[model samples]
Target: MGGSGSGNRWRYGIKGTVDASKRLDIRYLKQHGMLRSGYYSLSWNRGGEPTGNINVRMVSGESMTVIGKWRRDASEEWQPMEKTVYLAHTACAYGGSRSWFVCPYCSRRVAVMIIDAGYVACRHCLKLTYASCNEDMIDRSWSKRDKYKAKMGGDKGLYLKPKGMHQRTWQRLRHQYYEAEMQGWQWAAERFPMIKDWM
Candidate 1:
């Protein structure tokens, strides 16, 4: 799962979704169609909440569309949601058309929307959180360092250098990585003593 021969950068390219409403570009769909398709179980990242799985589907039609189902609960009944492409033909001096999804509620053009309760609107409408929303800056920083190390084939220990990277680039990244780690350790010690063993 590193970006080595058998590895790919799939996960890093995923843009965090704001809500259930995400857009699939018309031209892109016509060619690749659901560029990043997968079967995933999502927890809503909430404590004690029900876990659900979403099934994403795509097919050819008047244009192109992606139909999805979000199970309301663990029981298996799925709520239907769709992101279909729409082509708007326009006659301008330049002569062009636009392709976009309009929020069924707001009529504003949007690329993607998360399927929330009744809103079925954009991330702004649904109030989704980024992956880091639940973490402090220190924790995020430490995580960044860990990822950097992993990329360099270093594990658990610091001071390992990567192959093929220039000295200047490596030094810059190494400095930031350690600085972040120290900040995280200091913060952890003061606030949560039990974390010492874990860290």
Candidate 2:
């Protein structure tokens, strides 16, 4: 299966069976994504000169080598008589694009509104940071700090301070929760950049 992501990012998933004795090769396909970006390169020892290109080889007669590989079109057929390579192994290159999200505290991406008063605190950081003004779909209630503490398995009021709650506490809690959750995500992203990218 293959699909396109936000901002025209492309993705492809290959899954099938290959015959080992038919001399069938699904190789010689070059990836246009990586070649345009100049991030990854591929070559073989059997060739004369190195082309710094990428290809996926399906069958090899005797593990031959090539000096350099040339960029090829990916829309070709896999043949049995041809000794080709596949370039569909290129990795993703997002170019620092943003992913969509929805949360008051999360400044990265906001795609939807959350409606949960009991966990007004951020699911990520357990901090009260967001404020929900609209009550079209769900009830807006400021979850007491005690309740949050109880749910999180900590001492009573140890993690919460209700000193200066706004009159619209529930609305504000949504905001706080979103903010705290986003911060927590940011921290986690710093620790594991690849994991954060996938998330």
Candidate 3:
């Protein structure tokens, strides 16, 4: 089951794809006024459970130092890791400015940075792909359908719109949900002929 055959077809390499969901967004920090000369803690959670966290000290428009403990893999012991990530600002079209993190390895400006191999870097430098990239059409469609369903305030079915949502918006979302649902069913039926009967 662990061989490099069919079982591991979707498995990524040793330093698996960096999780985009768990990232440091310079935009978020700037918007929340966290880009100041102070200390902050960044954390991540999975299903209401704490997974990991890091401490960041901001130097306001210059750079931010990240302090955390990380390990390459489960076999190795966790080690203290500290690195300073520089910041870059670009002018926006309308007005004001936007912030980005300068990738430590490539020196590219990126809005989000992920921790990989005990260091923080942009996704490109890490050569990582998103988990959704390995998903098939059926999976993508199901995800979209579920997202719209949840927006309408239920997971079982799309019957009524959630309160405070406009009629036109609800109609649009319902149509989108139905389309995604049908697409998911179509793909599933193609994979398993028996599923066509239920459809």
lDDT of 1 by residue, 1-199 (tens): 2111211111244434443333233455335444334432223333565434333443322233435565545787766765554333334476664344555555566555455432355555555555554345456657888876765567632465666777777777777778878876766665567877877
Please state the error at residue 106 of candidate 3 in Å. Answer: 1.7
Q: Which residue pairs does candidate 3 place in steric collision? A: none
Model 3 TM-score, 2 decimals: 0.74
* CA lDDT, candidate 2, residue 126: 33
| Candidate 1 structure, TM-score to reference | 0.53
Model 1 residue 97 distance off true place after TM-score fit, in angstroms: 7.9
**Model 2: how far residue 4 lies from native, Å:** 33
As a whole number from 0 to 100, the lDDT of residue 107 in candidate 2 is: 33
N/CA/C clash count, model 1: 11
- Candidate 2 residue-wise lDDT, 100-188, digit = tens: 22233533223221222211112332322323322111122122433444433445234454556544664455456545545445544
Worst-scoring 10-residue span by lDDT in model 1: 1-10
Per-model lDDT: 0.51, 0.30, 0.80
Q: Which runs of model 2 end up more than 4 angstroms from their true locations?
A: 1-167
lDDT of 3: 0.80
Tell me the tens digit of each residue's lDDT in model 3 across 68-179. Answer: 9987688999999898999998899999888789998999999889876687888887777777665666788888998988888885346766778899888888999999
